[model samples]
Target: MGRVVTLGEIMLRLSTDSGVRIAQADNFCAHYGGGEANVAISLANFGHDVYFASKIPDGLGEGVVKHLNRYGVHTNFLLKGGSRLGTYYVEAGIGERAANVIYDRAGSSFAEMTESEWQKEELFNNVDIFHISGITPALSSSWKKTTISLIEAAKEAGCKISFDINYRGKLWSQKEAGETISEILPLVDYCSAGKLDALYLLGIPEATEQENELVYYYQEIRKKFPAISVLYSTKRTVVSASCNELIGTLWMDDHYYESQNHVINPIVDRVGAGDAFSGGVLHGILAQKSPQEMIDFATAASALKHTIHGDCNQFSEPEVNSFLLAGSGKINR
Candidate 1:
């Protein structure tokens, strides 16, 4: 397995029980998660040597470190400082009611992270891939610079960069996201984005009525940012709060590949499915799987995430493969 490094914030997630509303909840369940951290956990579960880097409050960050360790993610580059960890709340959804997130992350430790705090040499040492998301840069102005610096350092260390444009509207505006992400895309080797991102963020014009929309957008993206050799995204059809249909797509080497559509019903939790898919795709790339296999594995990993309750996908690579083979809702015993 390859060594992977992911940099971003890990926040405290307080979620209501199933069918419970945050407004009506008497108590909540707590878990630690964030985009990059969730991806790191998923990679670790697949037996990758993954390290997660971020700043955490000294006394209050123990649980966060323990959470990473439990999933076999290294915390060596996780710096200690700042007054408090970022946090968010999730109101569980059922049937027609959609889930919602409320952020309380302003001025948190990771948002206030400075570039000088990280030792680039140690963080990227022998690392095969460096993964990150747009969320870090959206945190604050300082984080924007730090995110670029880390990407440059990882590139210098000969690590392939995997970037996910996990744009959060609450943190910044579409104009801000488009501007910042445009600057970062050139340095990225593997990217996670959709047709909407291409149109709005990259300023690609809408496809002609005859051209395949996603394929045209992806091809144009490659023309603009040739360094990015692989691009992937998922098409999600929300049937209801408890049911969804998902399909993973990958564009590589002038070819596009798609996975079987997975109909996830009675989803236990849907918080980290995208991160799980990202991790699985990275794992497939590192493991040198075929494009078809990569999309299939990634889609399966995403489907499995909806079956778990937390923000991390706890399934292993073998488990995901087994799930794919057995299909959904079947007894293993």
Candidate 2:
């Protein structure tokens, strides 16, 4: 696979221990993650040449690169400037309770990055694909301009654009998200987002019938952006904080491919699992896998992520394939 470029922020994550509340924890476990950074690490872990482009606080640059380097993501495109790195806190919840996230991203270097500070064409060197998340543009108007310019540069370079509509209601309003995401949809060759995102980002109303949502979402995207070559999403049934049922769906060439649902027990962390799915699907695309293979590989990778602790998907490519071949530990008639 050719080199892929991913642009977005990487934040400092301070997470509370299992079954703990954010306000009660005296100490926290530190990790770094963000939508685009997680995607870059996922592709890199799958043995693809991935370039992670972004800005961090001046002194924090080295630490950020170190984390990406540990995962094989190339950090040559990184720039530094802001006063502090963006940060988020996670409270890992238990059964019947959902995990909680608190964001502290304002005035961060990535959010403060100007269009002139980034040399898009130069950063895009050797890039075959460009990936981004909706979270990037929601940061600030300046970041929005930077994202727009970056997408335009990628399009000019004939690189495929991959977008994850990772809607964060805490960061921006639905109206703003819809407007911003709609602007970039025309340039996207591949898109990944779930039901709520479709509803908010594209103004698609929720289907009263649950089974119809994914297909409808796919149809609406094609209706809105005929240029999109592929659309995919993951369906998850969270039985509890410690367990989830995972499946992946893909739409391409007017056809749909759905993977078998894999049940995960004792989930370690759900943080970066979606990004893992994004990486796996993109990996399958780069490997020229069929639609069925793509969704299967992706869902299996996501299921495996639930068994690992931390923000990164620690499973190797071969490990993911092994799990895929294992048949989701259940047979459907």
Top candidate (lDDT): 1
* C-alpha local distance difference test of each model: 0.93, 0.86
Off by over 4 Å in 2: 205-211, 327-333
Best by TM-score: 1
- Candidate 1, TM-score vs. the true structure? 0.98
- TM-score against truth, every candidate: 0.98, 0.94
lDDT per residue as tens, model 2, 190-229: 9996678777778877777666668887887789899899
The collision pairs in model 1 are none
Q: Per-residue CA lDDT of candidate 1, range 145-170, in tens?
A: 88888899999999999999998999
